[model samples]
Target: MSTPLWIFDTTLRDGTQGEGISLTAEDKVKIALKLDAMGVHYIEGGNPGSNSKDIEFFRRVRELNLNAKLTAFGSTRRKNSVCEHDVNLKHLIESGARAATLVGKSWDFHVHTALQTTLEENLAMINESLAYVKNSGMEALFDAEHFFDGFKANPEYALAALSKAKEAGAAWIVLCDTNGGTLPGEIGEIVSRVVREIDAPIGIHTHNDCELAVANTLAAVAAGARQIQGTINGYGERCGNANLCSIIPTLQLKMGYGCVSDEQLKSLTGVARYVSEIANVHMPVNQPYVGNAAFAHKGGIHVSAIMKDSKTYEHIEPHLVGNKQRVLVSELAGQSNILSKAQEMGLDVNPENMKSREVIDRIKELEHQGYQFEGADASLELLLRDAYGGTAQAFIVDSFKIMVERTGGAMVTEAIVKLSVAGEQVYTVAEGNGPVNALDNALRKALVQYYPGIRDIHLSDYKVRVLDEKDTTAAKVRVLIESTNFKDTWSTVGVSSNVIEASWEALIDSIRYALLGMDKDEYVPEFVGGTHGLSNH
Candidate 1:
C-alpha cells in the first residue's frame, strides 16, 4: 500500500503576501469555497487575530459546513506570557476556527535576534501555545519556524523545540523553510534526523526564493513528513510558497502515493485556473501540470514523433492531469503537423493533394513578421480557410480613431469606428478605460446588428509581452487574445511596436474567427491509418 499524505493549503494565509495582491474577506471566502469543492484536506486561513478581514472570514466560514478543516494561523504566545491571556492565542480561539497553527522561532539566531528572547523562552512559547490550544479542544499544529536553517545552525536546539511541541500535544510538528534557502539534500538529512527523534507526525512548509520549493518539500515528504503545506498557485512572500498544484500530481502519479483518486485528478486544470482567477493574476503559460504549454508540441520532428507515439515527446498522457496535448502550427510546422492541426480544427488535409508546403512557408513568413499562431488556434484556422479559398469577408474595417484625455487623475479613452459590409456603411462610438477596449466595444456593437451572436463572444484573456525588454518605449509587443462563447474558446494573436495597435489586431481577428466559426457547421474529418504517427482519431 502507498503512503497517504495530507495537503494543507495556505493560499489565504501565505499566498496573499505576494506583491500587489490583497484579498478582502469576500474574496477569501469565495476561494475557500472553491478549495473545499476541490477536495483539499486542510486550509490554513490567515492570522484571524491580526486583522478584521481574517476574523470575519473565519466567522463566516464556521457557518459554511466546509469539506476541509479550517486552521487559524498565527505566531505562538510572546515570551513570559500566559497562552490563555496572550492576545494572539486568544484571537485564535475567538476566530471561530476548529483548528489552530502557531509558529515559533526554532533557529537560535531568530530566537535571540528577531524575537529578542533567549532560546529557552522561545521553546517555552512553543510548548505553552500548543498545550493551551490542545486543552481548548482544538487540533493544534506547531510550525518550527526556520527549522531547516536552524537545524543546520543548532540541530540539538531545533530538535528540542520539536520535542517540546510534541510533549505539548501538537498534532503535527511542521518544519518550515521560511527563507527558502534549504536544498533537497540538506532537507532530507534534517528531516530524517527529526522524524527519528519526534513521535508526532511531521509536515513541511516551504518558500521558493531559490525555485527549489517543490523539490525540497518533496524531499522532506519522502524522508517521513506525512503532511504537505503549500498554496494552490504558490502565492506568498518573496518567490512564493511551494505550489500544491505541482506537489499533488507528483505525489499521486510519480511518487506512487495514493492520496487522490482519478476523479479528483481530473479537477487539476480547473483548480489551478480557478485559483489564479480569484487571485486576479494572469495564469503563467509555463506553470507545471496545468500550464497551457505543459502538453503543447511545436517542433516538426517532435510533432511527427508525438503523432507516432505520444511518449516520444510527452512525459505523461495529458488526460491523466485533466489536460489535452496540443499541436501548435507555425513556422515550425511540417506536413504532418499541418494535417494534424487541420484535423484538430475539424478540417481535412490530403497530404498528396493539398498545398502542405505552401501553408508551412506562409506560416513561417508570418512568424518572421512577429505573428505567432502557436497560442492562437482560431487565427490558424482562419489562415487555413483563407489558404483554401473557403473564407469570406464578414465585415471590413474602413477607418477608426482613438482619443485619450486625463480627468481627475484618471485616463479616459474613447474610440470611433466605421465599417463597410457588402458596401453598406455603419459607424459607432464607445468609451473605455483604454483605447483598445473602446475599439473592441464599438466594433462589437456595430457588428451585433449584423451578427447578434457576437454578443456571446467575450474576451477571456489578454496578454502583452515585449519582444525585447531592452528597447524600453519602442519595444515591439505581442498580443494574445482568447475569446469564448457558450460552445468553445479560441485564441488569436497580433504583434506591433504599439501596444494598443497589437491588442486591436488580435482582438479583431479573435472576433473574426468567432464569426467565421458560426458559418461553418460541418465537422472536418481526420486522416488516420498511418503506422508511423502517434494515435489520433
Candidate 2:
C-alpha cells in the first residue's frame, strides 16, 4: 500500500498574500468548496484575526458544507500573555473551524530580534498555543516558522520547539521554509533529523524564493513528512508558496503517494484555471501539468515524434490532468508535423498528396515573411479548409475605411464597412472609442443581419506584437485576437505593417469562423484537418 500524503491548501490565506491577488469573503468560500470537491485534506481559510474581511470570510464559510476540514490560521500567543486571553488565539477558537494552525518563532534569531524574547519563551508559546487549541476540542497543528534557518542557526533550540509542540499534542508539527532560500538537499537532511527527534507526524510548508519550493517539498516528504502545505498555482508573498498544482501530481503519479483519488486528480487543471480566473491573474501558458503549453508540441521533430509515439517527447499523458495535447503549426513544423496536426483536427488528408506538400511550402514561405500560424489556430484551420476545397464563403469583404479625429479634447473614431453576404451587399458605419473598436463594431453591424448567431460572437482578448524593433512605426505587427461565441473560444492571427490592417484581417477571420459554425447546421466548428498551407496574397 502506498503511503498517504495529505494535501493542505493555503490558497485563501498564503495565496492572497501574492502581489495583485485579493479574494473577497465570497471568493474564499467558493474556492474552499472547490478544494473540498477535489478531496483536498485541509483548506487554510485565512487569518481570522488579521482583518475584517478574513473574519467575515470565516463566518461566511460556515454556510458551506465542504468535505475538507477548514483550518483557521493564526500566530501563537504573545510573550507573557495567557493563551485564552490572546486575541489571535481567541479568534481562531471562535472562528468555528475544526482545525487550527499556529505559526510560532522557531529560529533563535527571530526569537531574539523579531519577537524580542528568549528561546525558552518561544518554546513556551508554541506549547501553550497547541495545548490550548487541543483542549478546546479542535485539531491542532504547529508551524515552526523559519524551521530550516532555525535548525541551521541553533539545532538545539529548533528541536526543543518541535519537542514542546509534540508534547503539547500538536497533531502535526510542520517545518516551514519561511525565507524560501533553502535547497532540497538541505531540507531533506534537516527534515529527516527533525522527524527522528519529534514523535508527531511531520508536515512541510515551503516558499519559492529560490524557485525550489516544490522540489524542497518533495524532498521533505521523502525524508518522512506526510503533510504538504502549499497554495494553488503557487500564489503567495515574495516568490510564492509551493504550487500544489505541480506538487500533487508529482506526489501521486511520480512518487507513488496516495494524495487524492483518481477522479480528484483529474480535476487539477480545471481547479488551477478556475482559481486563476477568480484571482484575475492570467493563466500561465508554460505552467507545468496545467498550462496551455504543458502538453503542446510546436517543433517539427517533436510533433512528428508525438504523432508516432507520445511517450517519445511527453513524460505523462496530457489527459491524466484533464489537459489535451496540442500540435502547433508554425515555421518549424515539417510535412509530418502538418499531417499529424491535420489528423488531430479530424481532417482527412494523405501525407503523399501534392496539395499537402504545396500547403507545407506555402506555410514555410509565409512564416519567412513574419506570419506565424502557431498561435492562430482559426486562421490555420481556414487555410487548411481552403487547401482541401472545403472553404465556406459566408461573406465577401468589399472594402473598409477607418477615420480618427480629435474634437473638444476628445478623440472619436469611426469605421465604415461594406460586405457581400450571400451576394447581397451591406454597408454599415459605427463609432467607437478606438479605431479597432470602431472597425469591430462596423464589421459586426454588417454581418449580424445576415447571420443572427454572429451577434453572439465577441472579442475576448486582443494582443499585438512587433516583429522588428528597429523599424519602429514601420515594423510589421502581428495581431492575435481571441474570440468566443458563448460556447467555444478560438484564436486568429493577422500580420501587416499597418496595425489597423492587421486588426482588420484578424477581425474578418473571427467573424468568418463564427459564421462557419452557424452554417454547419448548429454543429460546432472545430479546426478541421487538411493540407497545411497559407495562400499567397
TM-score of each: 0.87, 0.88
Supply the global lDDT for candidate 2.
Answer: 0.85
> Candidate 1 residues 1-537, lDDT tens each?
888888899999999989867898998998888778777888888998888899888988888999788999988888877877798888888777878999888899999889998888888988988999889888999998999899899989999999999999999899999999999999998899888888889999999999999999889989999999999878899999999889998998899886567778877777777677667676677788888788888888988898789999888787887777788998768888887777676665778975888888888887886788888877777677656554445566778899999999999999998887656888899998788789889988888887788887777788888888899999998898887673455788877898887887778778777776676664221111110111121
Query: Could you say which candidate leads in lDDT?
Result: 2
Measured by TM-score, the strongest candidate is 2
Candidate 1 residue pairs that clash: 15-235, 307-533, 307-534, 308-533, 308-534, 346-524
lDDT score, candidate 1: 0.82
- Number of clashing pairs, model 2? 0
Model 2, residue 175: distance off in Å is 0.8
lDDT of each: 0.82, 0.85
- The TM-score that candidate 2 achieves is 0.88
